[model samples]
Target: MAHLEPLDPKVDSIRILTLLPRVDNPNSKELFCKLENRTLASKPKYEALSHAWGPGQATDTIFINGQKVVIRPRLHDALRSLQTGKGRSLWIDALCINMEDTKERNDHVNMMSYIYSRATKVLAYLGPSHSAFNKADMKEMGESYHYFSERNCQLISKSIYWTRRWTIQELIQAKEIRFHLGKGYFTLDNRFNSLSNASNGSWLDDHLERIENHRNNMHSHLQQLEVLLEMFKDLECEDTRDKIFSLLGVADDTAQELIEADYDVDYYQLYASLIDYHQSASPLQCRSDLFRSSTYDPEPWRENWQGFDVSIERSVRVIAFSNLVQKTLNSAVNQTPIPESLSLGDPIIARGVIIGSVMSIGETYDDYVSSWESNKKWKALLESTYKKDKDLAKWRENDAAFYQEMLKWDHSEVAAIQSCDTTKSYGYRESQDDEHITREALDSVTEGAQPRRFLGTKGLMGFLPPGAKEGDQICSFWEACFGVVVRKLSEDRWMIVGRATVSKESLTPAVTESVYHDALNYGTENTSYSSLLSRTGDEFWAKQKDLAYEALIFFKLDIPTLQKLTA
Candidate 1:
């Protein structure tokens, strides 16, 4: 290791290994590589070897430039298999980059995309020996076997090399890639030419398929780095810092600008900075995570995180109705240097208008789905859904349109929905075929099924987050939507439960201002959604307006205070 030489960074030069011809004892598992610098301008004719180090074990000795070097046995086997009698030149990250030099590691790791893309060819080593996983094993079942055996599927899924984070960008940016799966190999040109068909990306690992598809469809709203971050957050990596570091090479140019690669920062700051970026630049929508993903992840890190189920997409989105967080989150971009003292577990403080307290929550998700899925007709489903609820459902049939449109509780205006009298607005929507409900309207009702129905104080009826409770405050947080469920943990301390949707609202413009006072209680201590809406008069408004003004002064001009968002 002491014989390692540094490359001149002026021309972006890097080291490549030339595998020496086998010795007289060809059967020996010996490897000797000539490591030397190759500049990009000189057009080095060498293939880059991409492989996982695999838990950093299995000691194997190899000679480099007449000096002995230790590497993983898999890598040693790759050199032996890939080498020829003449010689084979390749750029292997483990040997080429001087790990002893921190600055050199930073420089090379930062531009991994360029290194892999510029290579003559990229050889991805998945196994160590000639008996390593190969598609040729499938030939015994049949050349045209449609379904892959459970063993082959298990082998592919369980392969550490396939799931490693670095492997993603290496395969993506490569100009050409050849597989080194022991005796079996395949490329885009050929899926070992043994399978029936491998035209689409199905031939690759599931992780690669998911990421590559997202990359292809990235021109749409899914272009943000958050998508990739959320998608591959759980991938395997030796170093925790690599969770974020590994994605930078393949992220969009604009997304890449949000954060810089600095090996000095701990994983906490790195993850916190990603949180800062996701809050500010991500698409306008509200996310409710299955776990506390917005706050922490289950990755086995230095920090003992409560891990996830590792199977589900924790972050789910629904249409947003307010612009509460826009101006407040903009300041996130200006603060580039994430403070080292930033605590990941610290709860962020947010100031907003307390709209209402949740009064009641409907049946559990499983029950509701069981009932709704079985009932085909829209009218029958609505009738059966509210049979137990005495409040909204009692008068719902009399004014079905008002109930369905959620305009019944909007005491401010009954004319909010133009067609209140049209029967089409009830169980059915207006369309060319008025006899049957539009499929979109029927499906949209439970598409992002919050499952539990809830009525808020002040007669606001809507769905609550999965984690939300009956008494949690549904706040209209500045730069956020209407149904953000927050609970008071202590005086002036609140934790976000999740985002909910307005009863029947869609993606409308977020209101710039609200008359909702911070301290006003819309519902009383024991009574639910009733009694609160009845107390009405100009005198009440007159008093409430004075209180609203007082609340504004208390909150300091309604400009939201930003805090670390924790669940």
Candidate 2:
């Protein structure tokens, strides 16, 4: 067994494998490689591999510098598949970094963004079932990804490479990226325009759509931490905290990570650094105890405060301006510069009052995602509850017009709710020729419901995030379309469970307005933001009205144990 050679502590210095060419002799068929130290400043040309080393033991052996080095089968296969040209080099994590050295591995992990961006090319190795790209996989330059068969598309979605947390950063950071699979290799230069399938169905379809969404986000440069977190929530790494850390490199917030992260990627300085980065998007900022001064505007964010993510402040979800923040901004007053409030991990002062509390909870997002039958159960529960509730006429008397308008639309006839389970049914229809399940809008309250639903303390219907409790207070941020759940931590300390909805009615497919549209919705600002007064609900933004912002806003901030925010 050969131990990995450790490099000196030069910050920019890195390890690379200068793989020796094939040995033609029949006696030794084993793949062999020799290690060498290279610095990025020297302009080393190498193919950086973005791969997953599965949980399996390192049972497969490859000779390194005439010494045996055991690696997981996945890496061994990846190495065997490589055709290292003479004098060409490779930087694959499994072999290049000294995993046994905690300090070395930590340093390299922090340098991942720099390494991938500097690479001549990046190969996202799918698995051992490797195949070389040919004319069949490459059309002209790279139009082949646009023409993959519906079946092949399914197979691409099923690839295990998509499940790794680290791959997300690799995908975003790669100078030029290619996907390798068993049947072939291809690179997507543009959005996936599948020539065959129009129906977005099955888990496979969800995976494909997610890829498209990933492309769209990158295409549009929507790399905010909240957006990336929501986009890649399902992705996993060995340490759950790395789920957040792995993404920091690609997030718009972390343009310059000046501080060294903890080995776990969560330390006091690093946490404060992230908090600083999150606030980088805020036009409403204080003088930097870190980073440059800003002419950064909150204008673009204003339009889509709820549509996109505002940063997370401590345990509280900071989506919109607190009413007080708006009032301060509106009144043009000084905040006395509570700079330490956030960076030191103090609770952000939320200025809004409690709108409601959890009264009754309903189906989980996973519940609806489990099956069509499960969503139908969600529908049945809501309809029986919302439609028949006589108390709505009393408690929500001011919202009479909304209830009446909803009843007129429901017509007391079509008893079933439309499937708004976007993950499962996004862009799906019964037939392409005819609209049988006539593809409902993805933003439709039915298509992208919250992870859960709950009856509010006021008998209003709204969203229920994962940890909502019976007495959790649904509080408001300034400009968001939805309200968040704040469970009392103590006398004044509160924990934001997540964004919850509190509307006039339950998850009904019946309403035209988003506030009352059974599912929690956002980005629907009209001439008037959704007020305490329920309007007709018809004034949705014209084009992308049905596009759901399906980001899970609650992430356990992987910071050093800090004090919870105080009210």
Candidate 3:
């Protein structure tokens, strides 16, 4: 391998690979390439490579400047495909960044956003092409709608190329993007144009249209963070911290400040900082125009808010009321009496409305034992055994022995039952019933401590606050996705118990009414809950109210109006 030059931090310099064209032989052991370092200030024109570094240990040999150089198999394939009759200039990370040098890696990473954004074009490599699309077939499918609908393309969409945290910014920040599928390259823009030319009104076109529209609707940095977290939650990275750091370049300026990329910081600290930033950020604002205007829907907002399934109608109503309240505040500022139809005493008028609640508080230890025994048919078997033997004492005394004899159990069970006389033990015994057993164990443990499992109005689950008993209200700010567990400290005050999760399902009207009543009953006697709002401050409350109102108003709109607004 040719001696690689160290990157000079004094000036912005990057290595561009000069890919040699393929020879006639297909089984050639080696490929040739040349690496040249150039300063970005000179405006070097080169295509950037965007790909997932699959299985770090798997590498292929390539000839760089007539010397053997080791490179990732994926990158070697990319170079072989991208090379043409004339050598192609490409800036690939594996070849470009000096991986052995930590300082070089850091500098290169920090400059990555700018590097990709300034690239002449970005070739998104989605690994080897599926056997379904050979050279002849690929040639015919070029820029066609069929090309995108191909199984290979679908695989490309789900590829690690699209899932990596670092590539999110790479794709979004690129000056232009092209897909390298095996040996074939194509542009999505060409596919869209081809579909437009056909005007066939196919489902593909409709889907593409939605995607284009969504892409056009650019999100703010904070909003992008929310989207990234949800979209890439399942993505893997060697360094857990890279999950957040990789996003800094593409993230909005404000969000970047919230989480500056620091490899030295622990991953948990990085995550905590992000949550803290979100919590401290001002609540959503209610736009009066959103209520009066017919073009609002709450789906986008709700999706952004929690990235969970939400009730469109309920979200819209909450937003409408929030917007209405904003108007009322405006009217009061102008010395006008609030409209009678929208009076403060109206049924809808409340400090905050319950959006969701926990499905079950939690199962007690007794409940857990009963459920398990019932599920396993142990209750009946034990009863029949006692009746047949006519010996209840033996049944109770040798319960573990009887359980082991009755059913095929595992080592864990044997251990758990043995420890039953001492410490608590719980775990899944089978793969199929793993989820069920895990949930039961979790519920049982929490319930044992008198912790009630409650859901936020918006469908989140968490425990009630410490010292919070059952039936205590779970309350949350309209702008906040999570809720708090609280009980009336007095007629006028409410004691904070701690945090609780939002429920996945919407609460029934009766449940909603009951929650409202509980809050109102205390609210009317004393301003404790009102003071709760005050704790977050009037500015924060107002902002939350506005967001809630906009969502509600959007929910009330007709489908056509909603589509038009979103469109």
Question: Best by TM-score, which number?
Answer: 3
For candidate 2, the per-residue lDDT at 235 reads 75
- Would you give me the overall lDDT of model 2? 0.50
Worst 10 residues of 3 by lDDT: 417-426
lDDT of 1 at 476: 51
State the lDDT of candidate 3 residue by residue for 279-309, as single tens digits: 3333232222322334445555444335221
| TM-scores for all predictions | 0.54, 0.55, 0.56
lDDT of 1 by residue, 124-216 (tens): 877743333354545432212233334454455455687687887787778777766553444643432422333333324456556556545
Instruction: List where candidate 1 sits over 4 angstroms from the true fold.
Output: 56-58, 129-154, 192-205, 211-223, 279-564
Q: Which ten residues in a row have the lowest lDDT in candidate 1?
A: 552-561
Q: Which candidate, 2 or 3, would have the higher lDDT against the true structure?
A: 2
Instruction: For each candidate in turn, give its C-alpha RMSD to the true structure in angstroms.
Output: 17.9, 15.8, 16.9
lDDT of 2 by residue, 1-567 (tens): 244666767547887887676657634447778788777677888889998888779898877788888888887767655644454588888788876677777778777877888888888877644243232543334322445554545555666777888987776677777776532356654224553343555564565465555545563445666556655667777754466568766765555653343464332333345444544544222212111235423453344344432232211324332222222122112212323443444322223345556766666544544567865765565555556666645544533433344334331111111121211111111111211222222222433444465556445555455545577766543334455555654442445444554454432222112221211233232321224124334443332244221111222222211111111
**Residue 86 local lDDT, model 1:** 83
Weakest ten-residue segment in model 2 by summed lDDT:
422-431
List runs of model 2 lying over 4 Å from the truth.
25-29, 84-88, 130-148, 182-184, 189-221, 256-260, 264-276, 283-347, 351-353, 357-457, 460-567
